[model samples]
Target: MEVPAERVEPKVEAAYRALGERVSLPGFRKGRVPRALLEQRFRGQVREDVIRALIPESYLEALRETHLEPLGDPRVEEVSFAEGEPLRYRAVVDVKPPLAVKDYSGVPVSRKEVTVTDEEVEALLQQLRERAAEYVPMEGWPALKEDLVILDYQGT
Candidate 1:
């Protein structure tokens, strides 16, 4: 999808100004640097910020213009910026494919019946009792198959 020139320009300028506010120069205090000096000193950083800002706005515009519902994030194809010019980029996106439901209302579904039994409840109670059981040190002859070994585990 193509992004309109008019809409993107103002956003680019705003991004540039915002970037200028955060950038520092040799003589200028924080957020007091001139726009021209900020451009000269931090062209790459400013362009990156402007492109980051422009892409989301441009993508939204592209979606509205084309009337497309995107399925996932768009893949950025290309981005370009030059001094005193608006940032530009191309993006490729996957849109939701057209679909039709056939006999959806008549589709048969089955659910298994479940009932809690006294035996199952007793088994669960037994497990909880085991979890609450205290561990006591026993005279060892190495660990056995059923022994629960409590050890302090440490790792780097």
Candidate 2:
């Protein structure tokens, strides 16, 4: 993405102005730093801001222009930036491959008949009987710790 001077110069100027609005220097109130002073004191910061703003914007523009849905974040490289001039850069990125799908209608699925053993059935029945049983009062006997439960069941 090689942004021409016309585009980058304005962004650099805009970054300077935006920085001016937020910075406070000695002997001056906030947002009152002269452009020359800001350029002298924060040139590196201004360039960093310009680069940060330009890269993502240009990357998105490239993606839109190519109509590409890439897979990962762009790795930006090969920058050529100078004051009062254009921004030259390159980006490396990964993209998704075309997917291949096959064998829809003819796919075979296996079926099996479920079988339960007599022992399994009897164990399940015993569990059910214990769950359904309830305590009843004995009319003439004292309730003891050892007692037999008789469940009269008519199971479906």
Candidate 3:
């Protein structure tokens, strides 16, 4: 992928500005460091920051142009850049393979017959009956195992 110089320059400038804001030096106040000095001190970090910001956006744009969806993160390689020149990089990625239906006839499909016994049917019905069972308040005893305890409360 190639990102135009116009795109690359702005990001580089922004990176310098951001770095200048946080970096402190002996002669320069924070955010007032000279761009050339910042470049001298932090060239690699600034380039890396710009690349990190630009690559994803430019990569997605390139993918959209080619209508390709990558299966995973790209292995970015062979990145080259210069001032007043476009940023160039090679991204190795896996895309979905093309699919074609060669033949639909004689696909050799088989269906197995399913059978349910009367006992199974009776058991299913019993489960449904149990699920639908209702209990009314009974005069009497405290809750026991397997019994549902319901409570009533009033608050002011």
What local distance difference test score does each model get?
Answer: 0.76, 0.89, 0.90
Please provide, for model 3 over 37-113, each residue's C-alpha lDDT reduced to its tens digit, 9 standing for 90 to 100: 99998999988888889899999999999998789999999999876789999999999887898987978989999
Off by over 4 Å in 3: 103-108, 121-156
| Residue 67, candidate 1: alpha-carbon lDDT | 87
The ten-residue window of minimal lDDT in model 1 covers 1-10
Give the alpha carbon lDDT tens digit for every residue of 46-107 in model 2: 89999999989988998999888899998889988988778999898988777799868898
Q: Residue by residue across 60-82, what tens digits does model 1's lDDT show?
A: 97789878899999999767666
Off by over 4 Å in 2: 98-156
| Alpha-carbon RMSD of each model | 7.3, 11.4, 6.2
Off by over 4 Å in 1: 83-87, 101-156
Better of 1 and 3 by TM-score: 3
Q: What are the TM-scores, per candidate, against the unseen true structure?
A: 0.54, 0.62, 0.74
Among all candidates shown, the one with the greatest TM-score: 3
- How many residue pairs clash (N, CA or C atoms closer than 3 angstroms) in each of the candidate models, in the order given? 0, 0, 0
